[model samples]
Target: EGLRKAKSRLMEPLMQVDITTPEEYMGDILGDINGRRGMVGDLGERGNIKTISAQVPLANMFQYVSTLRSMSKGRANYSMKLANYDFVPPNVEEELKKGFVLETEED
Candidate 1:
């Protein structure tokens, strides 16, 4: 009833994020992105920092700000905005299932 109606009407947008960090941290960053089921759309260089463009799920991105801060030791900065829906990979789905835990929002 209500759940079905909400699911049918609820909407969210995809965001494109660009991060700048040291070259040495590329693998670590990419690994984290992959683990989060994110897709690496592009990579480039700008001065001393490596620029990485990735498409990440909005639901999973909630904790990204803090995580990136800790991972880069304050050397990284990112910007994101709405994009479009894309298919999530099979492996990512499996990983999410394994990591999923049943918890109530109120709890």
Candidate 2:
């Protein structure tokens, strides 16, 4: 029964993210990610600051660092890793469908 319960893990599209920001700007960073439909995996305090780990859709990641910098007053830094592709959040999916167009290269 235990094995059966743990047998499968559904894989979804994700971008592994680690963001570090000054304590005062934590709220802004979190709020920004929330708007992007990011899933917060962890949040912890480090000395006088905070770290946030999350999985966000690649589609929502365009210019993410720049956006964060503006919100955090240039005090935030983050690292991202390509996780895996999976279903996008409904809101993100909707936005992508509505306005995100891909430009093809000419051969």
Instruction: Identify the leading candidate in terms of lDDT.
Output: 2
What would the per-residue lDDT of candidate 2 be over residues 64-96, giving only the tens digit for each residue?
Answer: 989988988899899999987776556655554
What is the C-alpha local distance difference test score of each model? 0.77, 0.79
How far out, in Å, is residue 76 in model 1? 0.6
Q: Residue pairs in steric clash, candidate 2?
A: 12-86, 13-85, 13-86
Output the TM-score of candidate 1: 0.69
List residue ranges in candidate 2 displaced over 4 A: 1-12, 90-107
Clashing pairs in 1: none
Q: Lowest-lDDT window of 10 residues in candidate 1?
A: 97-106
lDDT string, candidate 1, 50-97, tens digits: 999998878778888898888888788889887787655566555554
Among all windows of 10 consecutive residues in model 2, the one with the lowest summed lDDT is 98-107
TM-score of 2: 0.71
